[model samples]
Each structure stands twice: as C-alpha cells, then as structure tokens.
Target: MSLLFENAIGDFELSTATLYSPTNGDLEATRDEPVPIDGIVEYASYHDRLDHPEKDDWIAVPLHESDSAALTGEYIAFTDHALHGEIFVYDDGDDYESIDRDAFVESTLAERVRFWHSDYAPDDPPSYFDSPIAEREPPRRPLSGDDAASFFDELESFVRAEMDAQRDANGEKAAGSTPEALREQGFGAIPSLSSLGQPEDGTYRFRIDDDGDDRAQDRHRYVQREFGIFEGNEVQLFPPNAERAPDAFPIAATVGSIEGRTVRLAVDWHAIEDRSTVGGYLRQKRRGYAVTLLLNSVPYDRELEAIARVRERDDHRALLTGETAVTFGDTAGVKSSQQDVELNQEQELAVSCALLADHLFCIHGPPGTGKTRTLVEVVRRSVQAGDDVLVCADSNQAVDNLVAGSSTAATADERSLHAYAQHGADEFVLRRVNAGNSSNDVVGERYATCDGRADVVAATNSSAATLDREFDVLVLDEATQATCTASCIPLARANKVVLAGDHKQLPPFSATEDPPESAAGMSLFEHLYADGGVYEGVGVQLRTQYRMHRDIAWFSNRRFYDRALRQGRDVASLADRPALVGYDVGGSEETIDHSKRNDAEARLVAHVVDELRTEAGLEAAEIGVITPYTAQVDAVRTKLTAQLERGREVTVDTIDSFQGSEKVAIVISLVRSNADGEVGFLDRPLDGPRRLNVAMTRAERFCALIGDWYTLRDSRGGAGDGTDLYDDLHSFLESTGRLRRVEPEFIPIPE
Candidate 1:
C-alpha cells in the first residue's frame, strides 16, 4: 500500500509504501510511484522499487510529533478485492489515549489525509491543481531632476516677491515719483526716491525763508512763483503755504528769471544701512510750467551680483590649492616668540632658497636637515619679489610653521601664506578650485580680482596637483616621500618647482622596484647622459648634527658611514669632521639586559620621564613615548603611571599616531622578541629589515631606546655580517651621526 505526504510551506509532495513481514511488524518505506491521489486525480500504478539495489528495500517512516499523534490508533488492513488496497483510520483504544483532536488537526497528517482517497473509475481523466499565490513587482522611485528644479524655481519666486513687498512697505515707489515736487516741499532729498530727473534751467523759481512760521506753517519754507517763461498749465506747489507766498508770485518761472538759471530737485530716496540707496522724483514737462512726476530707482542687485561672483571665484581657488584664503589681521594675535630656536640647516636653507629663486630645483635633505625652515626662507624671498607665494606641506604642523613665520614677517595687510592656504580664510580661492566644485575652463578666473594679486599659495603636494594655473614658485616639502605620481601634477603646474626632502631617509612608498645593476650602477644622471647634457647638477650635502651632543654624533657617524664606504655607496665621508666626538659608555653591556619585573618596564619608563621632566625641564605635552609594539606600549604605560600619584595626566600614543608629529623629547621602547621569537614594530609585520629600520628612526630632539643591545650584536654575528639587521642600523648610525649609545642623564624619583 502507498501513502502520500506534502509540505505546506514549499508545497512539495512525497510518496511512500508499506511492507509487511510475517515475523517482524509492518514496515513503512518510500516508493517511487505514479499514484492516483484525491487532490491529483488520475488513473496510475505504483512501483514496488527502483532498479538500484539500495532503493529496492523498505525503510521505516518517521513522523513529526503532531503527525505521530494523528497516526495513533490507526491500523492498515488489506481488502479482499484485488483492485482495492488496505486502509488505516483513527480509532480510540483502551491502552492508547485518544489522538489529540486539536493537535491532529493542526498536524501535517491532517493536511495529507485529504489526499489519501480517490474514486478509482476506469474512465477517469487527469486534472491539474494550481497554487493561489501571485508574483509581485518592485516599487518605483521618484525623479530628482524635476523635484530639484521645482524647488529652486519656487525659492526664487518667493525671494523676489518678499523683496518687492519690503520695498513697497518702505514707501519707496521707484518708477512714479517727482523730484521737483519733493524739493518744493522743502526736503533736501526724499529718502524714497528711485531716480532724480534733471530740472529745466529757468522753468521754476523759489525763495528760501529761514524763519517762515514755526507754528502756522513750518520751519524753513520756500516761496514759489510763475515767471516770463510760463506757458501755463496746472501746477502744484509743495508745503501748501499761502502765507509764505510773495507778491505777484506765479505758478512758474522763465529760463532767464531764475538765479544762475538752475533749479534744484529732490526725489524719494531710501537709505539702507551699510548697503545701498533708492529713490524717486518729479520734474518740469518739456512744454509747460506744470511739472510731471518722474521716478528713478537704484537696486542693489548689480552690486550683490558682483560680490557673489567674487566669493565664488575665491572659493574655487581655495579648494584647488588645499589652502584657504585668509586676511592678515586674523592671525595677528599669534606670537612669534614661540619659535625662537634657529634651525640646524641654516646654510643649507639659504642655498635652497637661492636655488629655488634661480631655477626649478629640488632640495633633497634627510629628516632633521631643516627642510621646513628652508621652505620658509624660500617663501620669504618670493614675497620679497612681489610674487604671490603658495607654501604647502604634508601636515598641519608644517602649515602652522609656514603661516606663523610668514605672518610675523609680513605687514598687517600683506597677503600671507596662511591667508591663501587655510580653509575658510578670506583669500582661499586655490583651496576651492576643484573639478567637482568648478568648471576647469574658469579655474583661474578668481585670481583676477585678488587685492594682492601677486599672493602666495601654499598647500600640500596633493593640494597643489588640483590647481589649474601655474604659481610663481611651488615648493614641496618632504618631496622624496611623495611618489612619482604625486610629484608629476605639481611639477607640471608650477612655473618653478622646488622638491625638498632627503632620499636617504625613505623613497616614495609607491615607486617601482628594480634592483640597481650594481653599487657602481649608473645613476639617474648617468642613465640620461649625453654630450654637453645637464649631467653635472650640484647636490648639497649637509654635514652637521646640531641636535645631538658631539660625542653621540661622532659615534653614530662612525658606525653609519664606515658601512656605506665598505658597500661602495656614494655616501659622504665625515671621518675628519672636528665637530664629532666619541661617547664612552664604560663598555658595560650588562645594563642592557631586559627588565625582569613587570615594574622593570615601568621603572625604565619612569626613568625616561624623570629625565625629561628634570633635566630637560620639558612639559608633559612636549614628551611622547614611541615603542615598536603595542604590548610594549601597554607595558611601558602601566609602569610609567603605576608609581605616579592620582589625578596626574599623561598620554601615550602609538607610532602610527606619532607620524607627521614632533615633540621636544621622545622615548622609544623597543619591545624584545618573545619566547617564540616574535617582535613587532610600528604595527608592521615582525620582519628583520623593517623592524631594525623602524626601531631606529622615531626621534625629533632626543631618543632613549630600551632594548637588548647584546641581542642586537649577537644577531649580527660580530657586526661584520652584511645581511644582519643590527649591522644595517650600525651602518646608518655611523653614516648619519644621529644615533649612538650614551650614558643617559638619569634623574632619581622622590622616595
């Protein structure tokens, strides 16, 4: 016997068969069948099994809880007839509880029971059943163009109506007032006049009375009359005073009858505070003594239009340069005393400025070579030439320095670099000049109305690239750090481009990589070499370390330069430089051991803090801790603050946050490799070359690195291994004279 089942949700059907064994109980199984069901009417036959051996067996049928309840007390019984099959029906038994009526009706069997039986007639034809559900379509969105246009049009109409109503309410009839009538009423110039008509030479005459009649008439009246030129028509006299009239006073005057043959007329004029004026008037008609009212109006629309155009152009230029236009007075309050220290690259700065003045040049200097100071001098010279200068740097600190210095040197009204480079500043047109904000064709139009037309524009390299017009001089700080792609735009836009940064520090992150042929490989100059070509361009090498002590500088230079010379690199030789000195650390490698206690890291941090606080007399804000790993940062932070009293404020930032930042003193904690030989630096992967490079370079004025110098030496295999990480760092120190081990100045903490 076969059975049918259906899934209500997806509406799929399953057919099954029952098998009987004389020894075992009845077994239920699935069968592939062409069965005639009640819901699906057709004459069909059932197959006992499929051809596959696995499918030829009967399996037990499992039912859900609700379906099992519906099957209680049901029995399968075979009929005597061949065409008829066994049937099962729900029945209450003594041992079995009655199948739950509610549960059975809500079960899947209750829905399947309706399809169990069908009238099996030989002439029956097949019929189909269709689902009641229907498909749906997605909703539509409204059009933006129509809505936007409608909004703006409505706004314009509303503004125009409001302005017209305001004018009318103020008694300003622009097109229909007379100047002669206004003056005849003894007013100097009617405050509501639109326009004043020129009066005829002798058509009107008047006599002024300083003391006519304060009570009966009014103060300062005028007497009107008709003269020989009167071709009489209706005339209206103002002030309406018959007592003030003279004998034989007529309605009009002739051309020669008036003194100097001139008549003064007044009209309705409106004076808007700090904005504009409007008025109306009355004048004599060409043919008669009678005067006709004439009106003249002055609207501020033209002036407002000019102002808007100027503002738009200024905004466009500001966006293009990443520099906002500002007025000099806005930054006058900033003090110059804040920047009192002289830069170490003073001579190099002068040379750079001279080069920028002479030609399009690049001032390639490494970190601490004072590129920022050099660019400032370049800006100063450009300002001296009466050229508008644009100064751009990669960070806000760089911009601040440029603005602070330039504003201090410039006059109150002179256009400073800040005014042209800061956002929202008055002259920030270059900052606004972007393709999205303005049309490319009209990009430079704003510069036409600049009060100091030859102003300087300063911004970062990214900002400079967006400018459409060429500047008098384009100075790029940290030029070596910029990729070739970033450099191309500014180089193309400037009349003179100055690339300032050191290639030795770090090349652009995006430059293509191809190993140089050899140490003696052809340089950029040699590759492009030709007879009488520009191959001998001068390169300036700065050989000074003003920030470090002479001994520290000497040790660092010895280690860094010797390796470069050994590698056959074109590094500068500083062996004979007298300013260099050697640091004697008592030859003790024992003090370099990793701290044992959790408090050891804290003590080390506290030591550095105490040194900065006592010896350098630095403020907390001027000090920063830069570590190679986040764990080490956490360790050092905990240690530094553990011993401090409550309510003390100190901040610790990661190397990522410290980038493009400067501090008076920086303490570097080099997190040691863990037991598994893992170390991280600057959030970069714990690789050899990168770790060594990053761990050595994050200092502005002072650095105190806490790491195992012994591990560094052991890793290098006696300092001669060419591939060793420490060897690389040692070589850099010798060449640059910027890093060296020394007896750090220690300050004891209070007990």
Candidate 2:
C-alpha cells in the first residue's frame, strides 16, 4: 500500500474508475513468470504514438470497437509504419493478406495462435485434476513469414523518420549533418555482442511479434528451446551444419542494429554454426536456464517413492540424502539483535525452536510480533556455529528486511569473527544491487559489492534459487503468504526449514482462482499449523505483540488468537486504552458492485479520518485507513489525498501493507455493503478470520471498524451458503458489548 501511494498510482489515478497496466516482461521466464497487463484504457490518442505524437496524426480506430479496423480510418497511409514497430498508434490490428506462408514454413516458424481453437474440453476431469493451460487441441495452419521481412524494412524507415522529428534525441542533437547522413550514422552504430556455448546444435529465431513469422517451438526438447534473448525479433536460415554445430564459425552473414542497451540483430545458420562471437553476455542468461534444469532434473523416481513412504509414516529410509539437520552441526548459540537487546519469552521460544535442529518449525508471528527479529537471530546463531544459511521471504521488501537485519547483526557485534564464503560464482546477480554500503543496497539499484559480506546469503525465494549449494538452515519469514511450491524452493537447498508466519493474517495471494485449488495456493505454514497437535513442539507461538494496546487487542486476541496473545510490557501504560469499537454505520450495501470499489464508502472513510482528527484529538500520523480491496484502497486514498488538509499524513492501504507496521488509530472501511449478507471476497468463510484478525489488531490506542455489521456478521459465503469463523467473532463482540451500530456521515448535495 505504501508502495502504491508513494511510488505507483498518484492520487487522481487512484480514483475507482482509473485504469492500470504493466508493459514489461520478466528477464527469466522459468524463475519468474511474466507480469500481465490489466484494465484496458478506452483509447490510444496521437500522444500515445512514438513517432508522430501530434493530435492530428494518429487515426482513431473506433470509439468502442477493436483495433482491427484501424486501417479503415482516414490514416491508412500510417498502417505500414505501425506494422513494423516503427511507430505507435491507437490500435494494433494487423493485415493478414500482407504475409507469405511458404517463407514461414521454410524457417520452421510454426505458430499456435491461429493454428488451434478450444474445441477439446472434458465433461468432468475430477476435482483434483489441474492442467497448466486447461485444454489442448489438434494443430492448425499457422501464419506466414513472408510479410515479416518486409515489416522489418518498413520499421527501419520509421525509426529514421522519428529520429528526424525528435532532433534532440538520438543523433538529432547535431545541427551540422543532414537528416539523411544522421540516419545512416544512427543505423551503423547498432550494438552487437558475441554468442556462447562451444557451437552445439543450437538454434535461434528471428521473432517479430505480430509478424506472420513469429512461431512456436516444440517444448519437449531441451536443445530446441529458445531463450528469446532480445524481444524475440530474430531471423535465421538452414544449412548442412544445421544437423550439428561445427567446431568453428561457418562462413555466414549477420545483420545488426542498436537502440540504447538493446542490440537488435539477426544471424544466419552459418553464424550459429560457430560460437566465436557472443559468449560472455550469453553466459549471464544462466539465471532462468538453471531454474529450468533444476525443475526438470528432479530425481522423480526415487523422490516419489521416498515421499510416499514418508507420508504414510511407514519408512523414512531414503530421499535425496545429504545435509539433514541431524547431520548438520549444532549452534553454539551466540546471537544478538541490533542493539544487543534481550529477547522476550516469546522471541526466545521462537529462536530456540530453530536452534534445536527440528526438521521443521512453525513460528506464529502475529502483527508486530517481532517475527523477523527472531528469524534474524536464528540465522546469525546458525552461521556463527559454522553453517551456511539462506534466509528467504516471498516479497522483495521482506527479503531486504531480513538482509538489513543480518547486515546489522554482522556489523554490530562479534559476527566478524567467522569467515564467510560467497555462495556461488556470481554474487547475487539475479536482480541484484549495483553498489552500496550494505545489503539494503541490493534493492532499488544503488548497491556495493560484498566488500563487507554478511553472514548469510539472503534474497527473495526465487532469486536465491540459482544457488545449488547445501545449507544448514533456511528460515522463511511470512511463509503463509507464499504458495506451498514457492516456499519449498528453499527446501531444495537446505537440510532443515523454519516457517515463520501467522496464517490467521493473510494466506497466499492468488490473482486467478479463489481459495486456490492448485498446489501453488496451498501454504506450507497453513498446512503445518492445521495438521493437528502432532506439531506441538515443532510449532512455537509468539504471543506478546508490541503493536496494539491491551484493551485494543482484547477482543481480537480472545476471539482470533484463542487468547494466547498479550500486549508488550513496555506499552503497559496503554493497557487501559479504549476498547476495540465497531460502528455499524447501518452501512448500506449496494448489490455487490462488480467493479470492486465504492466511492460513497470511500468518502465515508475520509469523513471518519476528519472526525477522528477534529473530534478525538489525533494527529494524521496516528491515523490509518485500511480496506481489504485494492480498488477500495485506491478510492479511499484518492479521497484522503485530495480532500484532507496539509500535514495530514494519514495512510490508506490494504492488509498486506500494514502487516509489519501499526499506527495509533486504525480505521477499517469494509468495502462490501450488500444488504443480502453477501460480503464479497472478504467474507469467504475460511479466509474471513485472517483478514479480520490483521485488520482489527493493527491499532494501538483506538481501533475503529466501520462496516455493515448485519452483513459482515453473517460468517457465510458470498451468497450466504456456508458459515465461518466470522460468525463466532460477531457473537463474541456483541456479547461483550464491543459492537455498536452507527450511521454513515451525511454529505450535502451540491447546489
């Protein structure tokens, strides 16, 4: 949430109706999936054009229709430029008649886009069956490669013309040279790098997206796989040596062009018949290459049998044996925090579980429970005992947070006494720090080398996956937020694992399915926590929370945590804090808006923020507005930022944003207000408690909850079909006199 307001969406862009999207792909496909675009914009104006950005230039396709009709507009002359990536326009419809089919087949440029349709689906494949792409169909005819060569030529012309218009950019800054001479010079300077691998039977492609030549490859073969180095715009030919790579560069032809860091080029089959060209940068592409190998190279046969026996509790004989916790050395237990602070009972127990060499440990860290602190100490102690440690978290912030702690742990005390070994050949190069004083530098580009190597190798879960070295311990903080598969990535390199998270806060974040049925949605922490009391010693609960006041936490602790959590002693003065209160607001619910935002509720949240500041004597720093929905969060943020007075630093965010931090007063705006007791996604019977638990427990002096009590109290599914944990919370709050009904603030109509 902080990232949204501070770095991403501005106040106006946060309006419920504003659209958003991403336009980039991940460098490594196997390690990180490409980010998907979202919420379509209504139109692309001339200002959106890369070459001709004037209002009169781009011809609009249609107000509501698709871009396929762009050529029918008055600007048919500009269609050629758009076809070859030379200029941008309002729509991206292509001209299928312009492509040549035989040229495409000659290049083995087969495509699946036009070849198949969704005509093959199952009637019932059973509840557990989950296919990656859902369904498959027989092959169909693909597009042509004939038009692709012409498109690149047109693209070259577009690039030269745009350079002339933006005189200050590219080679245009000079006034001496004619546009023709500058274009020639610009085209000549396109950068090129050498290729790698001792010239095996490796094949590359000349893929121009939307061009008929863009083809799909057979994924079943490893050598035939395409890494897609440069935006996939590649070209190639066939020869006698195509059957196997030659020992030297065969007599070949190559074409190259450059625009900034990307060197756009095409090489013939002759060039790839040898590797005397690009080797260094090609080797750096090892990130995703290794991930693919690791995933496919699993010892399936042995691991499957071992897993079955272990699961049935019959024989624990053989799995991938090596660095089990029992074989790994034990810790001498020399650990300390940033300031050498003493650990509370809860922190002590959490750290003790990790040092005891348990195969698995579940550390329940509720809001402000110092979960990261305990995990840091565990890693430091284990490393001091002469064992390599890999600390991982699901998000980048959490990963950097742990590294910052370890950086402090290493520099603040006698951590320098131990000798450290860099994990692999490269020093954390998968999205790494450029240069800085410490590990925090690893984030956001400013970073330094490991001049001062910390005791542990820390990174986001997948980022550290390239390291195949065995480690003594792997601590996963905030484990419940990651899917079971994501959390297990560290287990592949560790003997023992520790899961530190509270499933009662937020489960795995899946944008697709609800209550994720796939293995990716099942969280490891959730599984171990709910697997019965057999996990007594392996699970340690951190009950003392420093975030909420005693009175503020009374209801949530008793109702959510089974009364196990306590307020820290240092904050004992706040024990007499006003009890957690709920204002029903008789908040009327609309018939569940599909847009997932409520402007009226957003204004009400701003109204609550104003009332608290003026009536309750609280500063903006003490107030926070929280919602469960992203759209609602955006809506409320827009209201507060645009309407609130200066110096009002009130933050508006979601549960994930406030997970590790807290404010004096937290106001929750339950966006769902349906009168039918349909609480939308937030009211899911199983996930309801996690959302409510984190929301209600983030307050220190005051907890203000504004929602439709009638609807939220139902504890049922979206359609009121099933019951859940919220039912019990509603009963407890009503019985204890903590619940009350109120009205939404009255806003006057404009004259």
Total clashing pairs for each candidate: 80, 18
lDDT of 1 by residue, 316-386 (tens): 22211222211111110111111213444443433433332222344544333445555655555454444
User: Looking at candidate 1, what is the lDDT of residue 118?
Assistant: 23
lDDT of 2 by residue, 581-643 (tens): 666655444333343665666776787677677777778988888888777776777788778
Best by TM-score: 2
- Candidate lDDT scores, in order, read 0.34, 0.47
Estimated TM-score for each candidate: 0.37, 0.52
